[model samples]
Target: MELRDISRRVGIAAGVVTVLALAAPYAVLSGGSYASQLADYYASGVVGGAGIALFALLSVVVVASVERGNLDPGTLAGAAVVLGVATTLSAAAWATAIEPSPMFRDNLWLVWHARVVVALSVLIPVAAAAYARELLA
Candidate 1:
């Protein structure tokens, strides 16, 4: 297959994986009397939810581009770049703006989970940009 076609398929696969990752259980707290409380505290946050929504939106944009076969490569590239930038900004906000609960200090796993979420969030844009570059080439 041509580079463009290969890149498109890879992009779609990446988008699917990202969507699943966002939906999957990031970290499971267990074996502690405070685990339930920590889980509740984690679930009460909005930044993570916002980050997931933004990531989902970006994924939809990338996936939807495939349906618009008439769109030129340049246009697709531009869309991907723009959405990628927006996703990156959202991830940055999610990573820095979240205020972890004092309880989280005792549970380092939650910290790792947050870092993983931020990493995955950042990766979506990187994948989009890579796809865009390939499309342009």
Candidate 2:
């Protein structure tokens, strides 16, 4: 897994997620952002959660797939870490930026959602950084 390969994958995944985030009808199933229909805020959060998971998975895969030649394992871990951080922040963004509806202000689960959210956030950056630095720098 050369740095370029991992970086490319990250770019693709990021691009896909970004596009989805922007192009959807935003269901708002559970927590904040809506997708198709208005789901529970918590359930709706799964959409973003999938994206976070994809980011983390990309880090993990890059690490696992291209460990021999030019790819560094640490890069993958770094990507995972960033993804985790991003996930956490994303949840906050939803609460504050994306959704932030007054209805969820009193909710408890939304706060709990932050835990996994943060984890995803941390994972992506660390993973991408791990590989991206190697690929780019």
Pairs clashing within candidate 1: none
lDDT of 2 by residue, 12-89 (tens): 465344434422323333434432223334334544545544544554454445545575555554554565455545
Report the Cα RMSD per candidate: 4.3, 9.3
Per TM-score, the best of the predicted structures is 1
TM-score of 1: 0.62
What TM-score would every model get versus the actual structure?
0.62, 0.37
What would the per-residue lDDT of candidate 1 be over residues 1-137, giving only the tens digit for each residue?
A: 76556655555555555455444433444447666554554354444544555654666565457448876756766676666566556555555655677556876665555456556556555656666776666
lDDT of 2: 0.47
Report lDDT (Cα) of residue 35, candidate 2: 29
Candidate 1, 3: how far from true, in Å?
4.9
